[model samples]
Target: MTTAIAGRIEIVSDAICPWCWIGKAHLDGALELLAAEGLAFGLGWLPFQLNPDMPEGGVDRRAYRTEKFGSWERSQQMDAQVADAGRVAGVEFRHDRMARTPNTVEAHRLIRLAGVDGVQHATMDRVFRAYFNEGQDIGDRAVLGALGREAGMAAPTLEAFAAGDAARAEVVAESRALAQAGINGVPSVLLDRHLLFSGAMPAERMADGIRRAVAILRDRAA
Candidate 1:
């Protein structure tokens, strides 16, 4: 049997993190670019809650950002930066439609459970779009269930799973462990658990990292 490269790409991010969304787009583009170069690798999503302490009902986004960034003006600047990047990634970020800053624990939980059905990417993409584009509340069970359906998951099963606390603890624990590992930002890319760079990186940079990772795996296999 021919040996294949044995490494996976893990993207550590939160749904509400605009940069992560943009970074994911870049990652997708990078992966496609590498695929054209005859490199294909597995992709995984590692959960990270942007607001672990958010209220169950979430907080007013305007108030949250104004306070978190120390001023609304500064928050606008950050949003504008992301908006510019989003344009490059083809993601039209609807910050104006965003009302609440949700506790993304449930959203992460949805991704975790979605992984079991082998639609993790589709499910995660839907969640990101629902929040960042459609301005939908992803923290809600109904919304998550609907997204699961969109991702080809069985509706009743997804509903039951989302309505319960399955995978919630594991998601939180994994995110906590990731923080303990000294990574404090979203859009962090890892090749076989080896940290590459944090935040949204350029597509060429991601492709280079993937290419290098594949080379290392091939050497080890040989």
Candidate 2:
């Protein structure tokens, strides 16, 4: 069966970004509204590492966040703020369960592979849930392989993909390119090469942006 797509949407984000997850949910809501209007899109998940210099295994979440945020109390407050926003987006954030902030390069590479397997959305969702809600270590190869398997990918294929560096350099390069392009944030969404708004915007606002982008794209084509 073939699906009729109006255009392609590329979302540049990191695997461990809570705001990116919330942005995805809002984007899903926007798509649902657009679907009712007979509009559809193909999604592309791009890589943007929030912590590209972190160690391979990663550091303790409390220690890392404390140092980054200036104190444990400040970090908790920030997490609470994000949690409150997440609740409005229908996302469950288990910040209390999150212990370690894992390096997400491997996870980003897997997302690239998932795109080829036609399960990128599901794989991204799985990674988000694993890190945010389930508090699982996304940097672990075994866990990533299991996530791929759950997303309908073959275990053997995932194992081989994990054992070597296939999309590693590509992911890093893409992330660097995005940074060089002056996009230093996650959840930077682009539709048909037209950059939409950034941040976890409301569904209605997102829909409006998409509508405007579609109109501009059609005008350009015309």
TM-score of 2: 0.96
Give candidate 1's error at residue 125 in angstroms.
1.0
Least lDDT summed over 10 consecutive residues: which range in candidate 1? 1-10
Clash list (residue pairs), candidate 2:
none
Query: Given candidate 1, what's the lDDT at residue 57?
Result: 79
Model 2: CA > 4 A from native:
1-4
Per-residue error for 208 in candidate 1, Å, reads 0.7
C-alpha root-mean-square deviation, candidate 1:
2.2
Against the true structure, candidate 1 has what lDDT? 0.85
| lDDT of each residue in 69-109, candidate 1, tens digit only | 99999999998888998998878998888888888888888
Task: Report the number of clashing residue pairs per model.
Answer: 0, 0
